[model samples]
Target: MTLDLPLIWAGLIAFAVLAYVVLDGFDLGVGILFPLIRGEPHRDEAMNSVAPVWDGNETWLVLGGGGLLAVFPLAYAIIMSALYVPIIVMLLALVFRGVAFEFRWKTQRGKFLWDWSFAAGSTLAAFAQGVALGALVQGIPVANRAYAGGWWDWLTPFSILTGFALVIGYALLGATWLIWKTEGHVQRRAYDIAFWVAPATLLLIGVVSLWTPFLSGPYMARWFAWPQVLLVAVVPLAVLGAGFLLIRGLTERREIAPFLASLLLFVLCFIGLGISFFPHLVPNSVTIWEAAAPDNSLSFLLVGGVVLIPIILAYTAYAYWVFRGKVNAAGGYH
Candidate 1:
């Protein structure tokens, strides 16, 4: 049986990437919300809420990058090379944030500085990812399995808008998360923040959804095509519904519902993006089959991937399950 190794590898990589985005996304959201909480105790509670799983959450990014490199060397090379600067900035930001989490508690002298570092790092990383996504969606110049565009190509108005949109979106995720993991003043504050941020997030989602279809000719055709259009139409409607649920949950002071609703918005948006791009990894540039490594290479990697990915998922679930509960300010991870 000649299995379509490329297709399998593509699916695996996609799953890894999605896992990274959703899992790490909320924790990063926590960091973004760092400055908003009033007192030291509240901030500590917020930090502890994520401390146990934040490092593990980032493992998905490594898995995604590793899977891409192993399965599709051409796409990996081209995309990474194109996104070198933003990637470096993002990594540096995350590193600083990670260190801040550790060192802030060890010293009282520079705790405030560390807090700002965490917030700045998280915001920068989130914005960088959004910019990278926007740049990819806008399409990079590719020729002969290499980037043909300049470094500045990714720096554009659309990319900036997308970056800010992600900031707001992640902030909403963070606030809703606080609602779930905390109580009293922190929870109430989160509720208040969510009420405003949720609407802005929905507006940005609307703008990005409308703007994205215009950027790619293939996307335009796929989105607007007859019978398919009706089916594709459901994605946006579902996103709107999710947004409404998120707002309602926030207004009603429900704990977990708001987070779940926000998460649904993200999932639907990802699914819509996948539908828009389909077989193209880089959007109208390199295809999965074309960018895929040799079948022998993919087959070797696939074996390792299948065994290891499940282990990662299992441990990630176990960690979340183990740490499940409201974060106590007096009895935090510290």
Candidate 2:
């Protein structure tokens, strides 16, 4: 049987994006919750929790962007043109956070500035990502294979709401992560923050889920249409189940379960998005096959990907394994 190279590439790209979101998201959340964490030691503890893996987590983003450029150039061109502002903002914020990561350890009186920079950068990056997601979900106007929308089209009520949702969601991930990796006051504060943040995050998720369907007829039908709805509609209920686990794990004081449940919630939401955008690289615009590079080009990349993806995975897994377990003030790599 012949392989569907376009479809395969689409799945790979989606997997990379999801990996970036789930992995990088929690660390960003840590930065977003920086203000609530008091004391230099505590803040340092918070940052240290993710210090080992934060930079490595972004590898998936590079893979996703590069894959999109090489494999689906048309979709990349269109989406990039549409989302230049938010995408640029995200990159800048990421840079600021990265700087904060290293510089915060080196400075004395000026360390506070770096701390704030980390928080602001993480919050902005998460919000910008959410806005980009909302804009894409709402749809980009394309005419003659070019972006036909206004510059400010991405700034919408729905997009704003999504932006808030992601910020809160990432914060929840951070809090849960802290609960898993910290102790004493930092852990207590993380639990407290998560106690409120969890519900708030769930509410935002519900709002976004409700708001998503009415954005487009295809989206509505994808989730709500008869027969198919039977399957897609289960996602919300599954989210509720996942929420239950998050709360249950928190209440029971389980270390890892809450974090896993939080991740499950994101995974389910991502699956819903994937389902909604199936077959369309540009969401109701460009089909995957239409947007993909030639088969020969795809095959060339696939060969390299076969070797490179595994190496990346092996290194990533090794990093996490080497640095596994609780990250207290005394322990954990700097």
Candidate 3:
């Protein structure tokens, strides 16, 4: 069988990216919501809910970045150059958040400092990520396989709006997660936040969805053109359905349903994005076939990719299984 190696690698990279967003997203959500929860015990319980898996959740980011660099060096180079500032900011924030996660419990006097650090770091990282996504959809200026835009190219009005939308979305996810992983007052507070945040998240999604089609020529065609139109049209309906399920689940107070529903909502959004830019790695700039590395190099990397991806999947599943259940202040990382 002739392998469409580039397409395979593209799919792998996309999967890794989606996995990172959905996985790390909720934990980051937890950190973002930390400031509003009131008191150490509640915040500690929230931290405990994600402590075991947050670091592991970020592994997909490495996988996504490494896969891009290895599989599509041209695209990677152009994208990294275009997104350098936000990417750097995001990484630094992640580092601060990780350190805060580890050190918060060690000192009684500085716990509040660490807590603020964690919240600030998570907020910045999430905003940076959304900005990067906005920049991608806003379209990078690529010429001669190099980034052709200035440092501020990524900071458009659309990008800023997307960043705020992501914060609300992540907060909603974090609230649903708390509902899934905690009991008593913490869970109740999560429910309250989620009830309001859910509608707000959907509203932002609607604004972004409506605004997106007009921003790029390809997206305009991808979302509105004939056959492509019909096939792509289901995304919004699916998002609506997912949102409905999430809202209903929350109202019913079913622990896992709301979280799963939120996940479904994200997955549908990811799918819609993947569909909108099927073969294009940089939207109007580059295609997978155009950006892919040499076949021999991809073949060599494929060997490791085939072996490693499944192992990562297995371990990720195992970790969630091991850590599944209610979390409390006393149960947190110490």
Q: What order do you get sorting by TM-score, best first?
A: 2, 3, 1
Cα deviation of 8, candidate 1, in Å: 1.4
Task: Residues 5-43, candidate 3: write the lDDT tens digits.
Answer: 999999999999999999999999999999889988988
Q: Which residue ranges in model 3 land beyond 4 Å of their true spot?
A: 332-334
Off by over 4 Å in 2: 331-334
Whole-model lDDT, model 2:
0.93
Question: What is the alpha-carbon lDDT for the whole of candidate 3?
Answer: 0.91
RMSD of each: 1.4, 1.2, 1.5
Q: Which ten residues in a row have the lowest lDDT in candidate 2?
A: 325-334
| Model 3, total clashes | 0
92-198, model 1: which lDDT tens digit per residue?
A: 99999999989889888899999999999999999999988888888888987788999788888888888899888899889998899888888888888889889
In order of appearance, the predictions have TM-scores of 0.97, 0.98, 0.98
Compared with the true structure, what per-residue lDDT tens digits does model 2 show for residues 156-215? Answer: 999999999999999999999999888889999999999999999899988888888888
Q: Evaluated with lDDT, which candidate comes out highest?
A: 2
lDDT of 2 at 218: 91
Candidate 2 versus truth, CA RMSD in Å, comes to: 1.2
